[model samples]
Target: MTEMTYRQALHDTLREELLRDENVMLIGEEIGIFDGSYKITAGLLKEFGARRVRDAPISEEGFTGAAMLGLRPVVEIMTINFSLLALDQIVNHAAKIHGMFGGQLGVPMVIRTPGGGGQQLGASHSQNIELYYAFVPGMKVVAPSTPADAKALLMASIRDDDPVLFLENLALYNTKGDVPDHVEPAEIGKAKVTRTGKDLTLIGYSRMALVAQQVADRLAESEGLDIEVVDLRSLRPLDRDTVIESVKKTNAAVVLEDDWLTYGIGAEVAASISDGAFDYLDAPVRRVAMAEVPLPYAKPLETAALPSIDDVVNAVHETLDAVGRRR
Candidate 1:
């Protein structure tokens, strides 16, 4: 295994896929000359040339619709905040084409974008709007926290014969982790058990999954609590079975998300536990989510609005306390 940053892992995977498949091409604003907003496509233009590394105008809807018709196009929307501009194409056409045409046609395209707050891009630019795409039935959403999973999941998404929304967290770009030397594509709808515990289950995806790990370590050291951490790698085809099984074993749960609380991904997780493990649960399912407001531009406000390690730790403690399991 080789240690690499999350951004480098994504870049390497894209480069590997582009070389491996002739049909796979990239499309996005400033992806060519600018190397992408986050440099995920840094040197692709030079290697693949203009034909494969194509750039588009600032028309998300237009280009997204056009890319959907092409052969295995991986389009980057700059950021999830900007993805709102392409919602009509994403929700109405790309998502519904296969079903609308009775499976005769499929939009085998991947929409890659970063979300979550940390750099203080203000309310307009900094927001975890993954719930928008995750709510849609036709779109497949996956958010990987580690460099290894990032490469594997992206490889899988590019090959899938359906529309996929690859959600990246802005805060995770610089984070480094060990990536496999011979990486394999990860299954799209699976949750990974990162840590084992019996006191409570802490579930999260993307950035929150990383945070959950941190919380688990703290709880283990400070409170002598055995907290299990489940990373929800894929959001759309959510691995409810894994979540339910973990909750059943732990008998308690606390869902952490970078998005807002109401109607967020946590709500679905909590509901799934209630449906499948209601009798097994020893306490109410809890959630830790961003403040339900436009993420503020100021540093302090943004930090407060976004969910943190402390917030997750507190939620876990509260859930354990509710079940009288706190040490």
Candidate 2:
């Protein structure tokens, strides 16, 4: 095992994959000389040279569509907000190529971009619009909250024979965790139960997944609650069974998300729980999410607009109260 920051894990994994596969290459604006906005590709340009680690013009649509015909391309959009500019290529081309050609061809591409608030980047740059791509049928969206998952999932996304939207929440970049020395590629459509308990389940993805664990720990220590936590690592495939099973065992649930509450990912999860485990539920499912407004630039306003530990804790408490399960 190796302890490293999330940025380091992604950097090392990208380097490793580039070395392992001759056909694998990277594409995106400023990825070559600038080392990427997040520096995940730092030194990669020097090591692999421009052909493999090519920098691109400031055109998301143009560069995103430049995936090599028979090669795996790891494209990085400067930020998730900028991915909107490339939606045509992402949704119409990369996603539909395989089915559009009746399975003769496929787009083995990975689009990596970061999203999330708390950096005070304002609404335009700090939005979590993953649902836009995840809404499409052909894209696989995976958001990793830790360094280990970041490494494993990236490896899997690169090798998979489909377009994968690899979401790297901005807040997790500097966070550190231990990664396996020889990690296997993660199964793309699976959800991981990071914590197991008998009380109500706390479910989330990406940044919220990490927040769920922290909230679960705090509740365990303070309220003497045994809360189960499910990390929805893959948003699109969304392992409903895992979420359903956890809610069944706990008889209640509280969902957390970095996106706004209206029709957000949490709504889908709440629906899945209701569909598969309605009989087991003791109370209405609760959700804690970002305020339904364009995020403000002020740090305090941005912090308030985004979901927080207090919001999650309050939701958990309310759910437990409704079920008469609070200790």
C-alpha TM-scores of all predictions: 0.98, 0.99
Poorest lDDT segment (10 consecutive residues) of candidate 2: 62-71
Candidate 1 regions off by >4 Å? Answer: 67-70
Task: Identify the candidate with maximal TM-score.
Answer: 2
- Per-residue lDDT of candidate 1, residues 1-327 (tens digit): 999999999999999999999889999999999999889999999999998999999999878875445589999998898889999999998899999999889999999999988788888888888888888888999999999999999999999999999999998999999998999899999999999998999999999999999999988999899989999999999999999999999999999999989999999999999999999998899999999999888899888888889888888878777868888
Backbone clash total for model 2 is 0
Question: How much lDDT does each candidate structure score?
Answer: 0.92, 0.93
Per-residue lDDT of model 2, residues 236-308, tens digit only: 8889999999998999999999999999999999999999999999999999999999999998888889999
Best by lDDT: 2
lDDT for predicted candidate 2 compared with the true structure: 0.93
Residue 129 error, candidate 2, Å: 0.4
What are the runs in model 2 whose C-alpha is more than 4 Å off? none
